[model samples]
Target: MKNAFVFLATGFEEIETLGTVDLLRRGGIHVTMVSIMDTCEVIGTHNISVNADSLFKDVDFSLADALIIPGGIPGSNHLNDYVPLKELILQKEKEGVILAAICAGPMVLGGLGLLNGKKATCFPFFEPTMTGATPTGNGVEQDGNIITCKGPGFVFDFGLLIVRNLRGEETVNEVAAAVLAPGY
Candidate 1:
């Protein structure tokens, strides 16, 4: 099975994180929720608390096929500021692993220069932060190994896209049908 790590820092967007996890798991990916904070329980921006499957330092990411970042206020900033996470992201990029982010989460990629010369999309206000990237302002945009989405409204599309990238269109179709998602 393909393995994926979803980072859960404090103040993460509940819908984007959990929705993606749900979809990926349904598509047969082994999804691991990783907490970057010192504790396993991380609170979302809306005050929802979720216990991560593992701490950031406790998991081996060598098998990861994808690294997912969900966007929310201070959560995105925390992810961008975490040195270890940033380093891992860079390493993953060098290995050609898929890097996916939603909303402000793409800011982390933007700040790391990973978006350079790539077409990406993020929450409108963060367009400037995506240095060297062409902001498409679409609900979902995929440029090679990187996948980005606009915001909460597009979480399902974002998740389905990631599933497609990691698995295949057939798996995406199955998952989408199971979920009864429109326009699959």
Candidate 2:
């Protein structure tokens, strides 16, 4: 099975992270929970804790067809500052890999020069940093291989998006039917 690497770091939004994991798994995509920290346990922004499958230094993110980043303060900053991870992000995007970030995460991608001329969206807090991002009130935005979403409230939409991308329209429709959610 082709893997989708969902990068999880400390201070991640629980719902945004979990929502994507659940939604994409339902669509039959192999979702791997990768830790960006030294340990496998990551604490969420809401004070919940989730365990990761592996440490950031241990995996080859390049094996992933797509890269996903959930949003949080300073966590976004942490992802942007990690040299190795940043290299992986740029390298993957350069190779036409699907890159996704949500909420403050778009700022992380923008910091890496991914959102310069692309139509992207993020949590309202980072709008000033986006420079020229197009706002999508609906939550999720796909700009080429860069997929973004607003925040936790939009996690479901964002996950459905990953489903649509990895599994195609037919699978999205089927999962949407199973999920009983309007947006798919």
Candidate 3:
């Protein structure tokens, strides 16, 4: 149960949404995609209809070892609109669970003031949105258990980094060699 939970909303960036989950699961994490809606269905900004593993209410997110939010205009906005998603994000942080956000996703955490003084990195647009972040220019930044990545370009690195941290370097190397060596 290394992963425990992974949240995906409508309008999510296809790359960020899928890449991270795939990579982590390759490293043997138990990732679950929670939809923002009742039905386990979400349409990405690209109009890609991705079926989720469960409804947002169906999952006891508090049991998760980590909470992930992918970035995309509709995806992030969709997550913002869902009170349960926001609540889970806040509660995960309050309980000190590992919270990972990428691109605009960090803004969601910032809005809740979970990122004050933390070294965080997100898309250029989210810079202004982050009120109290250190604003690291690095492609990825991990502040304690909360890890943040830039965008889709860094999706592979973000996913691998988290897996390396959670599952150790050996599993990370094996997964990278097996899954990332060839183009997906």
Question: How many clashes show up per model?
Answer: 0, 0, 1
Candidate 2 overall lDDT versus native: 0.81
Ranking by lDDT: 1, 3, 2
lDDT of each candidate versus the true structure = 0.95, 0.81, 0.82
Q: Whose TM-score is higher: candidate 1's or candidate 3's?
A: 1
With a 3 Å backbone cut-off (N, CA, C), the pairs that clash in candidate 2 are none
Error of 2 at 137 (Å): 4.9
What does the lDDT read for residue 111 in candidate 3? 83
Q: Which parts of model 2 are misplaced by more than 4 Å?
A: 131-138
Over 92-122, each residue of candidate 3 has an lDDT whose tens digit, in order, gives 7778778888888888888878889899999
- lDDT (Cα, 0-100) at 13 in candidate 1: 94
Worst 10 residues of 3 by lDDT: 175-184
* Residue 34 alpha-carbon offset, candidate 2, angstroms: 1.2
lDDT of 2 by residue, 73-148 (tens): 7667777677877888889998888888888888778777778877788888787666556666547889898899
| Best prediction by TM-score | 1
Q: What C-alpha lDDT, on a 0 to 100 scale, does residue 74 get in candidate 1?
A: 89
Model 1 off-target regions past 4 Å?
Answer: none
